[model samples]
Target: MAGTPSNEPNEAPSSGADSAISNEKNRILVSDLMGDEREVFLLFNGSEYRLRVTNNNKLILTK
Candidate 1:
């Protein structure tokens, strides 16, 4: 059990390209991703999601 891989939906694999990008707590500025824009789209597992920054500076994500 100790060495068994997790079946948890939230568990991220610890290898390969995803691992390289996910191993650390990478810090990315919102300005870098959403420069001059209030919203951006994210593609994950073939689905699209929208991320928006509200006037009050709150973030919202919708599918």
Candidate 2:
């Protein structure tokens, strides 16, 4: 017999690092980073990059 699929909604899997990072106070919110915009430009090590929130509310960073 085959196993049945779960009926519960899928959720993001949590890892040890996720718990540790959530407990730390040195984190910044994504909303704060975007600041009323869906995208932001970042300059790191003399290279420019683009950070943006996708339509599905996920973040994407590109050079």
For each candidate, the alpha-carbon lDDT, in order, equals 0.86, 0.85
Question: TM-score per candidate, in order?
Answer: 0.58, 0.59
Give stretches of model 2 more than 4 Å off. 1-25
Residue pairs in clash, model 2: none
Candidate 2, position 20, lDDT = 69
Best by lDDT: 1
Best by TM-score: 2
lDDT of 2 by residue, 5-48 (tens): 78776545668787667657667899878888999999999999
